[model samples]
Target: MTQQHLEPPVAAGLPTPVPGRAAKPSMRELILQAAAVLFYAQGIRAVSADKIITKVGITKVTFYRHFPGKDDLVVAYLERRAQSERDAIEGARRSSPGDPAGALRLIAEGIGVESCAPGFRGCPFINAAAEYADAGHPVREVVASHRRWFKATIEQILHEIGVADVSGVADQLVILRDGAMVGGHLGHRGDPQVVARSLVNAGRAVIEYSQAPD
Candidate 1:
C-alpha cells in the first residue's frame, strides 16, 4: 500500500485582517441605538424587541443576554437620553456662569434647535409617559426622575434671578416647554426660525410675567 501524503496549509486561502480598523459597536450599544431610533420615531408600544433584534442583527438570546427584557432595553435607552439631556442642560448652565437669564436663554435656544431639527419628535419623556400610563411603571419612574431634575434646575435658575416664588415659575416654565415641544411636533408647520423664536419669546414672557409686581 502506498503511503498517504498531506499537503501543508497555505496562507493564501485566508483573508488578511486589516490593522487599526475601527471597532464595531458592542452588541449592547447596537441594540440601544436601534431601539432609540425606533422608539422615538414610532410609539414605544408600536416597537418590539424582535424588530430591534433584527435591526441590530442580533439573536433573541444575545439580545436578552444584554437586556433581560424589552422593558430593560427601553429603560436603558431612556436613561441614555436622560443623561444626554442633563449634559446639555448642565453645559448650558456652565456656559453663562453667574448669569441665570443667559443660561436659560441658551437652554431655550438648544430646545428650539432640537425642535427644528430634521426628524424632530416631541419630548421623549413625554412620549414615553403617554405610552406607559401607569405612574408606578419603571418607565414612568425614569420620566418622573428626569422631570424632577429639570424642574429643580429651572428653579435654581429662577432663584438666581431673584424670583421669590421659584416653584410656581419653574412649573410654568416646564409647562411652556412642554407646550412648545408638542406644538413644534404637531402644529407648528411654519418656518423653523419662527418656531424657535416663538419658544424663546414664550419662555421669556413667562419669566417676565412672573417677576412683574402683582
Candidate 2:
C-alpha cells in the first residue's frame, strides 16, 4: 500500500507531562511508542535514529540508553505488533469457547473489518519482511518467529476441530488471510461484508474438505 494510504503515526499528539504531576512517561516508553508508530507508518529503513529521537523529543544519548541501535528498536516494534496480534486472536478464541471453527471465523472477520478501517495499510509483518530482505537479519527473525506462532496457532485450531490435514489447511488459511489483507488495502472491489463472507466461506470449505470421507 502507498504511504499516503497508511494510518498516521501514533506518535502524533503524544501526551506530555502536566505541571506538578509525577506521571511523566519514561524515556524508554517514549522512544518505543514513537519508534513503533514511525516504523509502521513509514518504512523501517526510512526512519533513522535521529528521526525517532526528534519525534520522542529526546537526546541521542537517551535514545541509545533505551535501544542500543536501530535494529533493537525494529525488533521491539515487531514484538509489540506480534503481541497485539496474539491478543486479538486470543480474544476471538475466548469469545467462542470450545468452538474452534467459530473462533477462526471471528479472526477472519476481524481481518476483514480491520482492512476497511480508515488509513488501513497491509499486514505489518509482511511489510516488515519486505523491508528486511536478509533472513538472518534480526527484523526478519522477529517476523519469522511471529509467522511460526501464527501458523502453529492456526494448525492447533484446525486440529482441535478434527481436521485430517491440519498442517495443509493451516497453510492454506494463512495464504487466504495474507491475500485478503493485501487485496483489501489495494481496494479490491468488495464491501466489508462481502469480504468477510468470502473469508468465512473459504475457511469453512477447508474445514469441511478435511471432514469429507475418503
Candidate 3:
C-alpha cells in the first residue's frame, strides 16, 4: 500500500492510459519504472529527480507533471518493486499449474542470481528504508502488504493440500526465503536453489505424513 500504490488513480474511477497515454515514456508508470531501476540499483538518496529525468531523457517539468516531488517517486519505486514480486509469483503459478512444490521451487531459484538490480536488487523495501529511515513512509505499506500476501498465499496453498501444521510450515518457508535472499546478496557460500529444493522436499514429506493419519 505504498503511497504510490495507495494514491488511488489520477482520476478516482478512471483507468491509466498506459500505452494510450503520454508519449516516449508512455505514461506515469513508465516514468515510475525507470526511477525504480535507478533508485534500487543505486541508493535512493544517491539518485535525484534530475538524475531520473536525465536517465529517462525527460525534462524535470515533465517529471513534476506526473509526480509532485521526489517523495512521490520513492513511493512509486516501492509499488513497482511489489508489482514485480507479484509478477514472479504469478508466473510461477502459470508455469507450475496446481503443483505447489514446483511453484515454491521456482521462487527459490529466482531469489539467487548475480548482479545487483532487477533480478538481484536485494530487497527493494530494505533498500528504501536505508535511504529514508521513515517507518511511517507510504512505501513501507507496499513492502508490508506484499510480504504478508506472499506468506498468506503459501499458507493457503498448504491448507488446500491438507498439510498439517500449515502455519508453522509457512512461517518456516518465509524465514528461509528472506534468509536466502540476504545470503545471496552477501555472497554467502550457500546455494538457495539447493536449499530451496530441500525445503520443498520437507514439505512433501509433511504432506505424506499428514495423509497417513487418515
Candidate 4:
C-alpha cells in the first residue's frame, strides 16, 4: 500500500524556511491574513505591517514581497472578507431552502454569536472606519462596498418574501445586527443567540402584523 501526504497550496508559491502559521501561506496571503486578523481585532491604524510580519513570524522582506504596503494589504483583507460575506449569505439562503425569512434569521443569529469573540469589536469594517474615519483609506472603500452589497442582498431577500418595504426591512435588520454586535461587545455576557433570536422574532412579528387581515 502507498500512502500520500499533501503539500499545501501556498507551499508551491513561496520559498520554504518560513516558520509558524497553519498552511505555510504565501507572502501575499500571509500579509493579507495577518492584516485581516489584526485589523479586525485592533483597528487598521492601531496595527501596522510591522505587527503583521511579527505576528506572522515572517521577515519584513517577506511582508513587502507580498504587499506593496499596508494599504494594499488592507484592501486585500477586506476583499477577502467581502468574498466571504457573499459566500456566507448565499449559504444561509440555501440553508433555508426557499424560505427567505428563515435565512435572514440564520444570518442575524450567526453575526451575534456570543462566543465569536471577546470584546468582539463589532464588524471589522466598522472598527476600521472608526480608526480611518478621516483618511478615507483603501480599507474604508472596501468596507463601504461590502456594506452596500450586504444590505442589498438582504433587501433582495425581503423582496422575494413579498415585503412591501424591502429596503426598510433590510435597513432595520442591518441596524439590529450592528446593535447586537455592539451589545455583545459591551454588557452582554449571555448567549448572543438569544438576542439574535429576538431580533428575528421582532421582524417576524412586524411581518405577521402587517399581513393580518383587517
Would you list the rank order by lDDT, best first?
2, 1, 4, 3
Clashes of each: 0, 0, 1, 0
lDDT tens readout by residue for model 2, 15-83: 655678645455666677787778767778899999999987889998898899889988987887787
Question: Which portions of model 3 show Cα errors greater than 4 Å?
Answer: 1-24, 113-119, 189-214
Can you give the TM-score per candidate against the true fold?
Answer: 0.86, 0.86, 0.72, 0.80
Estimate every model's Cα lDDT from 0 to 1.
0.80, 0.81, 0.65, 0.70
Residue-wise lDDT of candidate 4 within 1-214, one digit each (tens)?
0001121233345566545745455656656656666776666788977888888798988778778787888787667767766877899999998898889888877775642445565666666677677556677888788889989998888888888877776787777777776675566766667766777787787666655677
Highest lDDT: which candidate?
Answer: 2
Residue 150 shift from truth in candidate 3, angstroms: 1.1
Worst 10 residues of 2 by lDDT: 1-10
lDDT of residue 174 for candidate 3: 78
Report the alpha-carbon TM-score of model 4 versus the true structure.
Answer: 0.80
Count clashing pairs, candidate 4: 0
